[model samples]
Target chain A: MDRASRGLPLLISRLDKDYAGKAGPRPVLRGIDLEVEAGAFITLIGPSGCGKSTILRLVAGLDRDYSGSIRVGEAPIRGPDLSRGMLFQEHRLFPWLTVRQNVALGAFHCGLAPAAVDALVRELLERVGLAHAADLFPSQLSGGMAQRASIARTLAGQPRLLLLDEPFSALDAFNRLALQLELERLWQRTGITMILVSHDIEEAAYLSDRIVVLEADPGRIRTVVENPLPRPRDRVSPAFNAIKARLFEALHVDTGAPFAVPTDPAPEEAIP
Target chain B: MSMEVSSGGLAPPGAAEAPRAVPSRAGTLSHPANWRRAASHVASVVAPVALPLLLLGLVASAWEAMAVALHSPLVPHLPEIGKELARIFRGGHFFGEMAVTLLRVGAGFTIAFAVAVAAGIAMGRQKTVAHFLEPAIIVGLTVPGLVWALLCVIWFGIGLTGAAVAVALSIAPALLLNILQGVRAVDAELLEVAAMLRLPLRKRLACLWLPSLMPALLGGARLGLSLAWKVVVLVELFGLSSGIGYQLNSEFGAQNVAGVIAWTLGFAAVMGVLEYGVLAQLEHHLMRWRRTAQV
Candidate 1:
């Protein structure tokens, strides 16, 4: 990273989020503080309901109900900006729109000339391998292809910060692997800052520069592990497996254990 | 219904695989695949239509048999009704009455639709609006078409205004309820996606809310149009000088069973054309996106 780009980090300081319940305001996220360096890939991985997605929501500026100071570069994120692109797990493409039209919508607020928007859409579609399916609607596209188009749509705006909330968790294993590789290539090509929320530890290990493991029950960041793997990571490599194992450990998974049902002790016996 | 269209056994080869969109064809079916496609298309079309036509035939035959067995003046045979229908067609008296009734339904339904859509949006968006407006809709639902027609006759003085108002009142509540439910059911996730993408408000509303409201909109229209037809007939039967309903009432007063059956069948034919030919076509076109999703 260059000196100028190095200083500008995506920072979250003392972040907190709550949901209103019959009892009171129930806290979802508590005191989350993290910094993502510019042009870096970071993954937030945790079990369900651990506020992994909430953190992305805050950065994407969709949830202003939360208490947090989220700064991208120097400016605070008060609301969603064109430069921060978000891709949800469901793809969220408009059913009525063709793939090209859906991708073109990413530039809807850009006010670009028609020719330029079309050119950008074409280029992005080609990159995502969805150029042939341009005229097809979301309902027509396969799950993987739809997700690829969604990624193309997000990239068409040339966002500086990309937020992905389990963008490929819905896909089969093969498509998921292909998309992860494609994502890495895009990141390398654009140098856009990306923060992904995923449950798949292997996915996080494969794509991220740093993996932030989170724990549920009043969600908190358990630890952030630096990934020292080189580019175009070999998933079968010893180093990659080592990092994956460490991530599993950070998430408090019993990696060595096989499937089993625990037997309850006698009623009078003390519980471990 | 969509499932019947989508899940046919001869579902095209592409359907079993990636479900690539079938290119929309025009009149010139040049390719050989187009012929098989057309043949399969015919079979698919016939599958739905054959049963309904058969059912209609059975009902008509049963009614004819009942008329023959009873030999009653009240239940005229099919031939008597057919003869009366032919006479009415030749005289062209039915057309004028039909036109007047249709005009009233169109005007009344338009008014009801405009008001209900606006009100539904308001009710869905604001709890206070819903609280204030809900009781009126609930009470309106409970009030029958006859009562509304009678009340409207007193209020608007027994004419087009009275009939139209009655039809609108009878139909609006159901439309409003459907629309309110639709509005409330707009996907929060998609809205979040729109916001996160920084899509302009116009684009968001166009691509998200409008499309999301389609099922509700169509549901309301189908209900409203059918209800408007019924209410208008009741209103006209009670007091109007001219309409299909008035003609039916006159026929009933004179004990002309064949004339009543002819008018009823003729009116139903027009409604069938309007519903199956026009509204059904519109629904098919608008909901083409749903075809593959069902599969």
Candidate 2:
């Protein structure tokens, strides 16, 4: 509570979050110090239980248990606010709402007029290429399409920061690459500060400007590597391979993933 | 349907960026009028029904031939039942009794439906409330309908109130449990989304909760309807003042098998009409989104 950032843009000077008293004695996130400039694309990488999602949740004000402070421009985050947008791996579109109604909900609590919200909803629907399905319910959507609706709903509030928790980790190979590519273009166009949580080293390599790799158990940042790949990053390029290798090493995947090779195989066998 | 699938498919991050997204739902029927769509809807329904109708005809023929071979008065032909069914439509003293039974059942069922849905939604939304009240629901469900009718007679002293209460008590527990389970089974991620968006509570209930709970509600209604009929008849056979159940009891006492069979067929037809013409229509409208999920 003592530490305070004096109007110093989105500072996290020695941020520590713990959950020791809940059941057993343990902290979900401990001794985490990170900084992101305005409109930077930062990716958080980790193993399954590395608490990367916890870190993002903390920053988004969804979880308030912590030691060190997180100040978004001299203001401490206490609860979820309109300034932060979040998307999860499973698209959480409300089943009762049409695509339009679900997206419009983001603006429901705001002080905007109804017409403005309606116009914005239509504009967003068109942007997501779901203008025609705007009146359709979430159950009517395909998995990929539902995820798009989730992203559109997240962006509806025009939040200053977008926190994504493994948003594309559940998708098939084709959808994953397509969404990642779309994300790249969106990030370039929007210039919003983004903190993406992902387990896939290759995904972090291609999508992030700066990738922070984490190992589990204690959930500490193992490596903070700079992504040197050029824009419109080629996944097959040597530069991309080098970064992906570093991410793998940080995660201690020396013997390869417990299941099998995670890399794309061939055109027809790409799903494996 | 294709449009609905693709509309949700473009989850690629760029779809809502750079003012340029590939138009996936562009060519789909943007808004098919409810009336214009009814024609295709009827065709879809008829295509499936044509087979069942044929099967029913075959079954009726087999039953008639078997009855003839046996020369048993116990098994009557379909034509005799059809003639008796026409007689039912002519409106006799028995039909008046049936109308009274329908009215009583209708009142009891309506009361049960409203109370159960309300209680269920409240319990479903709050874990604390559900935990506290669940024991009472289990007790209600375990107790038999006839026992409740007996209790009602003891408590309310043998009138319409006693019979209706018996009907309500019999059906309410099933509906409550079914609706509660339905509500609880709703996806948690959707609630998280609702919380993040900060929707008005009413809109949250309508858009997120209601549609998800529809199947459970409909299931409860179906179960509750059958129970209503059974309980109403049981009450009449025992002590109800004037109803179809009393008529059945009298017929059974006199060993008029034809009269009993005719009433049973007539009641079965009523249930069939209600399910086919009413419940099916309601289910169709509520779960249209389910069709896309199937694809």
Candidate 3:
């Protein structure tokens, strides 16, 4: 249980990234600066082209081509490490392996003995409410079940910092809400510093301690809003709506006009 | 209800009764309709075996008719060939020859598989390795198995060594091509997952590469084994003095057409057992996950 407080702080400064476009190297991210405290939940919310996911990938060391500094607990990321676990939008489970095997793979490099690894896998499956589905392959799992199994796999690594790239965006509204609750509970229990990339305003408001709003076209941080809402947040609460309205305003400042699609027009109208 | 009644009224009594009677008749075991269904079900089950049997019967009848018409010793009847096959099985020397041929095939095929896998993986992973080996693979594929068999016989001077070498040289390119395609076709997303996990090379091979490449490897093995059989027999026919191919050669030398046919039949039967019995079973077991996933 001591590992519950093992979350590592992250620091990023003057980060710049470019992709090899058809014409030439095109800038994707520019002047990106952010800091995350240990055991804090941070959500990066932006429009579609904003380099939020790219920033997550860079921090995870999946891409090290960026020019700047990204340090996790005083060490610059050389490459992907066990300390950092990532979840993609897709479950990304190996179809050949059973759920048990996939979860066990997360613990492969942890240097645990075979029996210990087996016990860990069992505990993880149980924790994720997937004990009965342990022997099932990814194909046999429903979308929500598969994502839960993926979460178990990531947790098996005992990561200090968990990066989620729209991990529940593919799920239906009900499953997405269910998983969001589960993810919040997981973050609270494990105390892992979590960074999530999402476009969903409510999702960002519900989970994050600090929501970093980003602007597209050379993605850069626009503002970071501190959430005053308490834990076990109610979706319909006025306090939650206030924070969502702030995030929505931050997201639409660049467009001369207001965002056309108002999720909750009541809050926006009230603000005006 | 009114529409149904009107339609029922519009139809003839016999037509209405006939539709109901058809289902009732089909439900009865003794009915002609039920008998026809049972016959069709049995036919479906037996069709695969029956079609091949019918073809074999046709071939035999044609051979028998040709033998009767020509009245030649070279064109032996099916019974004469069957008798010769029985004679080959009865003789202890046939077993020894078969074992030798099989051993050579096994050795050659193993060599081909090992070399192909290593080379294929290297070529698939590294562009430099691929560029360096592409021309050699192309040339190897282009050259006929007969040419390799002749060269190997000349180089190794007639023995198991010569025959095994010929088989390996002849089939390795095709196997390599198969394995290379497999390696290339490996899922990139899964690989990215492995990289993100920082899985060790050993684990990566066991969990990711091996399973991903399994279908291709099995496919290559099947193709390579069949090719190995033909090449080994071919090399034995010309180079070695003891094998089924050697027996065929000896019979042909003596103008014993029945003996040649019998040896070929024996070889074909063994190949059938191996293809269906061993390789197929292994493939089914290894790929059981895929079958279940589909279900």
User: Ignoring the other chain, what TM-score does chain B have in each prediction?
Assistant: 0.83, 0.77, 0.81
List, in order, the clash count of every candidate structure: 0, 5, 0
Report the TM-score of candidate 2, chain B only.
0.77
Please give the range of 10 consecutive residues that has the lowest summed lDDT in model 1 chain B.
Answer: B1-10
TM-score of chain A of each: 0.91, 0.87, 0.92
Q: lDDT by residue for model 1 over A1-272, one digit each (tens)?
A: 44235323699989999988899988899999999988899999988989989888888888788776889988998798878888999989888889999999888778899999999999887767676788988887888888888988887776888899999999987677767777776677667888999989989999999999888868899998888677767676656766887787787778774633122212222212
Model 1 alpha-carbon drift over 4 Å, by segment: A1-8, A257-272, B1-43, B292-295
Candidates, DockQ: 0.28, 0.23, 0.14
lDDT of 2 at B66: 87
What is the descending lDDT order? 3, 1, 2
CA lDDT of A160 in candidate 1?
Answer: 85
Winner by DockQ: 1
Q: Cα miss at B36, model 2 (Å)?
A: 29
lDDT tens digits by residue: candidate 2, B79-160: 7777766665575765687788888788888888889888998898788888888998999999999898778877887677
**Pairs of residues at least 3 apart in sequence or in different chains that clash in candidate 3:** none
- After superposition, the stretches of candidate 3 with alpha carbons farther than 4 Å from their true spots are A1-4, A253-272, B1-74, B291-295
Tens-digit lDDT track for model 1 on B75-187?
99888899999987786788988999999998899999989988988899899999999999999999998899888878988788888899999999999999999999988
Question: Could you give the CAPRI-style class of model 2?
Answer: incorrect
Candidate 2's C-alpha runs over 4 A off are A1-26, A61-68, A73-75, A95-97, A111-114, A132-144, A172-178, A226-249, A252-272, B1-84, B92-99, B125-127, B157-160, B292-295
Model 2 chain A: worst 10 consecutive residues (lDDT sum): A1-10
